[model samples]
Target: MPVSLHGQLVVAISARALFDFEAENQVFEAGDDRAYMALQQQRLDEPAPRGVAFSLVEKLLAFNEGGAPQVEVVVLSRNDPISGMRVFRSARHYGLPIERGVFTRGASPWRYLKPLSAQLFLSTNEADVRQALQAGVAAARVMPQAARASAAHPHELRIAFDGDAVLFSDEAEQVFQRDGLAAFQAHETSRAHQPLPAGPFKPVLEALQRLQHSTGGGMKVRTALVTARSAPAHERAIRTLMDWQIEVDEAMFLGGLPKGEFLREFEPDFFFDDQAGHIASAAAHVPAGHVAMGVAAGQG
Candidate 1:
């Protein structure tokens, strides 16, 4: 029978997002494909260090041991086939059971997400991430300079998400953006019983929940809902998750406070938010990704 990714939690990651390719990427970014290819070829045998999303990918792959694989991690990068050799070498050196990849040279790789049935797509390229999100696959623009994940939770896959325009729709977020805090709080308080509409990442969260329930072998998934909503507005976010029958291990309603310190303490392997400000803050202390959706995300 032909192999299929139908029932798996497929994650499509860029080489730069999965491995520390920033230094190498600088050469590539200089607009010289020949130089970039030569550099990668020269260092083909060298293993790249783990990047920000490395921990999350490593832990998720653990779900496949001694059984039918439930998770699939595929490299979907813009690097040429020659440069991709180093990427594979790096993965093998780290013992990541990743055998699939698509090297698109300098083209956008978002087009391949559909074929992979990707539940999540992480890339350092903003254009690719925006394209993927528009195509209905949960995607995030990884902050390449973000701090690497903490080694404290080796056995657990700790993931955190922002509330508005991430786990929930941008309906309330639009209100907040247009009218300010008072109106946003009042709107959320009034609609505390109503569930917020599903956002781009909701499907990813639901898939994680299912995987958490079905997978075993000493691996675990812990999720957190970290948001800027506070007090009265927090009720609606809680109710929305309750309505969906999804449970998170932690929830932080920080109001307007900085999320970096709090996320540092949480030590999540990956964090996602719609706003660049929150992503900027979290990236300093933990690996962070931008959802690039909703009003807060802006156009283009």
Candidate 2:
């Protein structure tokens, strides 16, 4: 029987997260036997099994085992085409239901995927995903760990994101990245009362907000923001969220502390950040994603 997805959560991940996409590409492009041999050795030596992020794949299997509202995962990729094969092999080995696909030559894959319930699509190809989400597809451009974590926790999807790039505009991130923290803080403080621009995640947040409002009894889905900025800069983050009228169950301004400890305590199903270091650390405690906020390779 076809499983009914009403209120079910679906997540889509990228092949890069599954295997070493870049390494594979280098080998294929160079066609070097030594490189291929080295790649094979590296793959063999890795602690986690090959194909798809093992951490994520394992979580999906566990979710299925728990068995409540059905949770499904779709692995999406274009480069390293054979990556999907490895993902399938791993899922079968570990016992998880994960589908795989490559993007259409020109069309958006998300358009055809709307039938999946409560979708959470993750991709390094943020622009296309953002375009699809803006067109009203239930897609959220996230990293692999976040995608898996979101699927694992079906009852209450706890998602944590960094304020600047993950939720708000990259303009702030640009300022922070190009200039120094003081300059970025000055800019944010100037716009403290003013509304910050909505980001790629905004539409997804709005959709979740609508879902929260329509559903009975408070919010079944929860959100939180753990930001580096504190005090005055914190007010801007609060004001921006308030202006949007979105409900975030928790908000922590870590000042300069690394977010790993706080995120662990929060126990969010998934967390998102642009920095790999943060995602790498958080992925240990929770499913974490690295937001690729632009056009991805092999994307049309």
Candidate 3:
């Protein structure tokens, strides 16, 4: 039976998300002429993959095909004149549905794009995508290489997140980072049983919960919370998930232990955290993303 993408939304991110091109320039010095030519070249028709971004897009298509819902990929670029067309053709050849090709001159492009009833935006650019997310877009953190390497056989899409910054407000994180562990633990313990307030990733998590409910309690997607908080302080985390009414297959309160081992065992497709050390280590195993905290009221 043909898979139905009728209610599924998927996004394939390129350039901005997949690799830090600007950072790469500092390392390899591709220079203006080479860079300009590479950008302008009709490279998609060639036999080999252009880079990790294309590979990620291909994987997203396969992942969609393996599931019950229909999925489409939106190629996101910035003012690339011909890149979108090439991507569209390549995607069509692979039998994946190619939705509109989205181009944005700068960050936060998804804000202007209309929301699909059911959708998931996959990208490696955590900060920019987070902005779109804050504006209510259904975005997921997907690494270009990971998307390519992932199996296409409908394996459960396991996603893990750190509680404070990735899943809930950074208020708790700030209290801890700025004030000190004892004070932070006290605050969380005091409100230990109370639900934590919503943060940037709240909507995205809620959307996944809805999908889980729609699937009749079966595990179409598996989620986990692996954080440094432990024991008495864990109640707040529990209460927050409960309040959201989202079911995470697992929760690990690691306290001060390094998260790499747990992440390896869980084998999540992607893991999100605000700490760079954790992200660096986890990325070596599973795709990892760093969530940027919301800007303060007067920062901009």
C-alpha RMSD values across all candidates: 1.5, 7.7, 5.6
- The TM-score measured for candidate 2 stands at 0.58
Candidate 3 to truth, TM: 0.74
Best by lDDT: 1
**Estimated TM-score for each candidate:** 0.97, 0.58, 0.74
lDDT of 3 by residue, 87-157 (tens): 56555665556666666633445554354333445555665566656655545454444322245424355
> CA lDDT, every prediction?
0.92, 0.59, 0.59
Tell me the tens digit of each residue's lDDT in model 2 across 79-154. Answer: 3333345546555655566654553422455564565542566654566566555554433344433323334444
Residue-level lDDT of model 1, residues 156-246, one tens digit each, is 8899999988999999999988999999999999999999999999988998897788655478899999999999999999999999999
Q: What lDDT score goes with residue 253 in model 3?
A: 95
